[model samples]
Target chain A: MILNIPFSDIVFYFVAVFMVLLSIAAVSSKNVLRSAIFLIASFLGTAILYLLLKAEFMAMAQIMLYVGGVVVFIIFAILLTSHLGENKLSTPISQKFLAVFLALTLLGVMAKFLFNTKELSESITQKSPEASSLIAYGERLLSYAPNGFVLPFEIISILLFMTLVVAITIAKKDNKEEK
Target chain B: MLPSVTHPIGDFVRENVPNVLGYLPDFIQPYIPSAEIATLINIIICMVAIAVVGIAPVPVLIYMERKVCAHIQCRLGPMRLGPHGVLQLVADIAKLLFKEVYAPKGADKFLFYLAPIFVLTAPFLNLCVIPFDKNLQVADLSVAIPFILAMNGFGILSTLLGGWASNNKYSLISSLRSGAQIISYEISFAMILLLVVMLAGSASLGEITASQSGHFWDWWIFKAPVLGLLAFIMFLVSSTAELNRAPFDIAEAEQELTGGFHTEYNGMAFAMFYLAEYINLFTTSCIATVCFLGGYHAPTIGILAIDNILNFVPGIVWFLGKTFFVVWIYMMFRWTFVRPRVDQLMALEWKFLLPVNLLLLIFGVVFLAFGWILP
Candidate 1:
């Protein structure tokens, strides 16, 4: 069985295990900063999984956005807050149950999706999508034809612009108040 | 459509390096698996090459910076170590290696240990995608630009972590400053690179470098004339801030934050951060060389004899020369300029550089649209 196993499968399983461990560590850690670091590690593991799947762009985006931007921002918030990792947080039993229930439901849904999707199963058994170059990726992202992401992309850009404007306005108001 | 490298070193590894694997004794070959062994050997060779290329110059760079700063200040720097103090860094490194490594009380032990390592890895990760020469890059990933940006984010994270883990107020404040500065400047840095990508029509570093493989004027710094020059200057400014050098080095301002994020680090751990900084300096200069200057491509005048002679020199030499020239500029800035206030640093990036970057990007787009690229 070991001889029969493909090298890629071994790498995939290794990354999956690593990610699972990291996620567990993140959720179970008492120190908020430690949890955040663990979360970054999980994100990094996900990036490696993307690389294994030959989704280079997805991997880079994973690192750039989640591990790099979101987690760092979270750490900044944590550092700036009054309590710096000294909080002995305890979840109420009811809330913990609810979390578990919701988590199980989500896991079930994801598992169902994975097992029932014939296309995904077939694609996984075969070669995954060919690694597309950035040129093609950009073209598809900006193209106006069917299958193009242009409209949604533009909408997202507008949304981000609004968010930026709101953030700036709020920040400026706070500054003026302080002044 | 993976971008192809014209002179990829991978072929050399495949054709030549695997032969050495064949000499393995028959007794060991069956158990070890020759094919896997070959791949491992190839990977090791690549890693060694990357480490050598990315890290080996750090000592020399440190020495060079010291010398340049001293000369600029009209002082003799490190004259006793060796001839012209060439071995000064060697002695310094030895001292660092033997120093006590310790974490302060109340410090996060794990993070305190991990921070230097994480920070050190960022530049090496960045060096992977940089096309030093046509064949010298470790991996020419299609998402090289984004990868580099992500690595910059990684660097910032490590800095923040180092500061927080230090359990020192000065370290925290300095790291906070560093995080803010780097995150702000990163926007301009990414924008300038994006402008280059738009002109080159490819985000792959290898392809971008290949696109400029012609006359010197064809380089991105000259190709679009005013906009190109503007973009290059903006890149330099933003990258200087990114590197946290003088004028923009408000993060580790000695007058305020004692040793910055690395205040708690000692011994080789401190040296790791130091080495990472210089490596990052080299990597950024290399990026500047690849993007703005003709990467590895020799500059040529129209004179046939001169052009031929220039072309005869290898691309790696030209690549290193341009990179070091940019590095020299970075050193000059550190010594010559006065450090700005933290508020001023923020203002400079958010107010001045950001707008200029956006305008330059627009101008670059317009130039490209009108076919006004200089030949």
Candidate 2:
């Protein structure tokens, strides 16, 4: 029997494999900066997967926010904390066997859960009939209806505002102390 | 055969290729999938065309910049290099191509090589969305504005990677500055673009252009009058900062950074950065043209006779003319303004442009809500 797979599924698997590899590299990299760069690669791979899923807006947002904003912020933090030229940046593996055992057990549990979830497989196989246009996405995001994201959106905005305020206050306090 | 060609340029080229290919003999034509071949051929042709169009103007733009600066400074510029330095860019390109490529001892070899490719790809990818004529755009994605912004955002990585990979202090500092500067200005830039998107009622470039069609009064700049003008100015300022042009060019401030993020780049690698910059300049100008300057539409101040006459001129002409005009203005700004300090640059965006853009966005939403926009 011949195996039948859609083009999008092929793209999805390709991106997923790369994303997983990049994620592992990101975590396992000895250099902090290299780890951050690897994280960017993983984020980009996820963005491609989003594209394959036909979520163009989400894909672009992923790139714009993750690869652009968060990754750059992480890189900046890495630069600030570490001497980039120095090679002795890796952490010592204090409990290597215990860590490996825990990681393997967690992976196994996740695999078992994933395989056992019938609803998850069903959802994966059945593509959504209606693809929301960008305008509809915007409307739904701002709407106050039952399924609308207005509350969460507003909450996120307020959270961001509060974070900004706290950060500014802390920075100002530091400047004052220095003075 | 190709489902009724909408793009005149694409159609014309598509028609000519197969005819030309026909002379290659029966074997080649038979092997080709005749129905799907036009699209495949068109895609290749467009790729080549966009690359050519993107790069071909660099030398001319560079020459124009030098001459403009020279005239501004009351001096002769490249008088010997073929008719007021027309061939100067050619000579410069040759010099750059032959210049030795070098990497510092501590540089990350892989990333060091990759940075220039990133720089070059961003603007080239951006060139695809710009609607030159009614159907001339390569890809008319609905989220053209966001796509362009995202591509540009990715460009910051190249600077960051270039700086980090170079392992040079100055380069690192410049890259950090660029990263910070780009991210900060991007907020205001996106806000301004959102205002256009809101006003146009669609995110597609073609749709925005279509809405602004007919007369000069129909153009967004003149349609909404005060709000339109304000948005245009805000977009210009934010986009200028986004492009890292003066007075927002502290990232690569020559006096201090000595070439900034690309301080370690040499030869063709350096040229790639330079090429990307100019291409970016063009792309930004083109966006401004499409979003604000009524794109390819001829200006018609409600005069029927004048409008008819204007209609006789093809759209590509108007589009290129308007885009170049904006490009010229950007060039003028580069020579005219002094560079702002880094603090001033950040302050300008966070303090002034951001608030103004937010207010403009609010006003645009309100106008759009009430149907006060022009038809």
TM-score result, candidate 1: 0.93
lDDT tens digits by residue: candidate 1, B257-343? 887889889998998899889999999999999999989999987789999999999999999999999999999888888898988
Best by DockQ: 1
- Model 2 C-alpha lDDT per residue in residues A84-159, reported as the tens digit of each score: 6477645557776778889999999999989987775442325551364577788989999999999999999889
True contacts kept of each: 0.48, 0.33
Weakest lDDT window of 10 consecutive positions for candidate 1 chain B: B1-10
Q: How many residue pairs clash in each candidate?
A: 0, 0
User: Best-fitting candidate, measured by TM-score?
Assistant: 1
Q: Candidate 1: lDDT over CA atoms?
A: 0.84
Candidate 1's C-alpha runs over 4 A off are: A123-131, A161-179, B1-34
The regions of model 2 sitting more than 4 angstroms off are A1-4, A91-94, A116-130, A158-179, B1-43
